[model samples]
Target: MPESPHPPELPARLLADPEMIGACRRRDFALVFRMVKKHAGIYPSMIARRCDLTPSRVGEVMAAKRKLLHMDVVERISDGLRIPGHLLGLSSRAWESPPELSAADWEPPSRPTEPPGAHSLPSHDVGDILASVACTSPRASTVQALRSSIEDYWRRDDQHGGEALRPAVIGQLRYVEILLMQSRGDTVRHGLLGVAAELARLTGWTHFDARQFSQARLYFGEALRFAKDIDDRQFMANVLACMSLQATYQDRPTDALALATAAQDHARAIKGTPRVLSMLSMREAFAHAVLGSRSGAHAAISEAHRQFERISDSDSDPAWVTYFNEYKLTVDTGIAHARLGEAEIAEPLIAQALHREGGTNQRGRAFHTFWLARTQLQQGKLEQACHTAVNALTPASAVASERVTGHLREFSRQLTPHRSEPAAVAYDSRLRQVLPAGVSGPPPP
Candidate 1:
């Protein structure tokens, strides 16, 4: 067979134009200048001489002041720098056209404009009203809409009306897409690594959510591999923590302890921020607790508390790991306490976690609720335990997470003796709703 021929290189003009637009949009001057230098083969000093500006001034224009350039100035720069004006989308002829145009005119602006309603546009100007509403509306509305669409697709699958694999495959594809977007250009290495780390985390998480534990292990392993490849100590530590979480769910407490300890070691290897250290220590505490090691667990919890105490409100932390705050730390510490049979300490900590405003995501909240229910059961608050467990099952049912369902099964076993009670009956009904049909039996206590 003949060797495959190399792919054709993209035109410099085509590549540079998009980079210029992207840099302008993102306020990324360095990238804009670098692209100009690379594609145009013109030095800043040379452009400076022709444009009647100092080299440093030219640098500023390329980086920060590109937006400040008037159409005429841009034209002058393009001409003087030997860059085609058309490449910059600033040709004099294009701008000189009559204000009113036809379909054949230059491509219409890409931004969406409000279309007339069925009744047609009113005489009054409505642009201000629409602008005001757009400004006040949450930016997350877009994300929420996308999430809803995805859930709807999953709903179709749930009802046997769509491909069963659709949701999982789409989720995995989205994670990869985000990873690609975050990796391009001059993105900060640490920042890019964080994105890749998150992609892997979510890939694993979604599989874990779908109750595919073996598949989840594969994704989590890939994520840990990327985390290590980036040599980002903090990210690696976080990955280790996630590994421990997966192990715990799989009922391999020994593996959980080892992974959590590795996380602590990785965190210690670098001069990590307090936030990273707190997460590592918390995971360590959880691992030790699960393994029934009280002293080790308490010591890790104390270290986590100390580290958290040192974090100032204004400190700039990585977004992915910043969620590990005092509330979360307290919740994990409570888990440690619960495993150690310290009901008093565990109950209050778990309660505080539950009450705190938006301290966790949907999944985390479900897990915490499960734990609270378990603790309540242990403390003989059967009614309250059942209520909490049912509440946990409600959200847990929405997603196919084996981890959450496992907790439900455990709660069911605890409720078995009280099966005749109303609360236990309700709990059993909810558990049945979430579990697959014919799975058989309540979960082990």
Candidate 2:
């Protein structure tokens, strides 16, 4: 069969079943495929044709011998099989049901309630969010509403972590993408594109914090695409800077350096604001530090400080770059020094970062505290390091960040030599409750 224009929709009854909902929620293709065959009479070959999977792959999935994880593959399954995207932990699918209209929930300037994924709101269906997009006449208002919702999502992600926010965020992004497809006027289309870009970037950040690197790259790439479509040079630089940061985190210093440099090249074209330049400069510094180039790292870090000092007014800085202020700059500088093995220099700056970071920023605290502990250890202050590592446990346990957890594991391994010391024993007791049973201390590198 030449691929059907759209996959046939499932019976209304199958779509509403609680078991099917639960399976989709978990993204369990095994269970989902089995259910489809049993109830919908859609055999494996038909599934292969619709979802663009080979017959063997479908057989393996049904036999519990394969699992689907890539974002693109997941998208195909969602769109091809007529599944609502959010149910499968995705954004709204392309083939979502016809404009099932509902009132847009939040008005402009009002903070949005928490989204689904446990902490999420009760009503997260994309139909509700798309209600505003139907107002073609008031394009500016629609764009403004989209921007406001994104701002709220960012605030919540910054205060907590992004793991729980993915479902809602991706849901919004999908609605934006769908709107972008149908947009008419240049002004409204550009506005929607900008909104889509920001949402994609935020979604990528959520994935990055969870240590889901592959998925993060895909969304970041999507953000770049949206930004380029609008010829938004500044936004492109911003996404490049973000990609550079992700590369640095993954220990791909060369790729990180190239991406950061490309972003700085774009800065000349855009005449980027002081804060944006500083943020990009710091990304370069991170790559330099990873590459063991102390001179290069220090030069970029100094430039970061210099550009940041030139800021005329904090008011003019966009929300995207506003977080790259004093505290963030200090933390990044300290992290660069720590990577260069200058623990004495790193300790003070990291301490200040931990001190200035807000109480609600649990994930940030956990991350900074992990670095602080490591720096203390590098100075041979075993007891102090142990105590500092223990301090991170409180915040780390409270947040659902895989990156922070990995840092804690690395810190635990550093304490293996002091495993019997009194302070270390105290830390061990606390860590036991926080980490998995068999992984309190990871195998040495």
Best by TM-score: 2
Full-model lDDT for every candidate: 0.61, 0.80
* TM-score, cand. 2: 0.69
lDDT of 2 by residue, 1-445 (tens): 3766866888778879999988886668999999888888889998888887778878988999867754446667777778887777555654574554323323344456543321122244564666555543537888999999998888788677899899989888767766766788899988998998898889889999887888888788888888888888778888899889887676567889999999998875878889989999999998998777999999999999999899886436666887787999999999989988899999999998888787477888888998999999999999889889988888887877777776876677667677778998898888888765644533322
The Cα RMSD in angstroms, rounded to one decimal, for candidate 2 relative to the true structure is 13.5
User: What is the number of backbone collisions in each predicted candidate, taken in the order shown?
Assistant: 1, 3
Per-residue alpha-carbon lDDT of model 1 for 1-445, expressed as tens digits?
5322321223456446766656634334356556756775656876666544557656766666533322334444544544444444433333233457644456745555454221121122333333333322223343334345445444443333222443444343344334333343333434444444555556566666555666667656666765675677676777778878776555456788898888878877887788888888887787777666889988989998999988987766765576677788888888889877787789888988888837225556778888888788888898998888878765565554445555655565557678789888786777677656533242322
Q: State each model's C-alpha RMSD to the native.
A: 24.9, 13.5
TM-score of each: 0.56, 0.69
Query: What TM-score should be assigned to candidate 1?
Result: 0.56
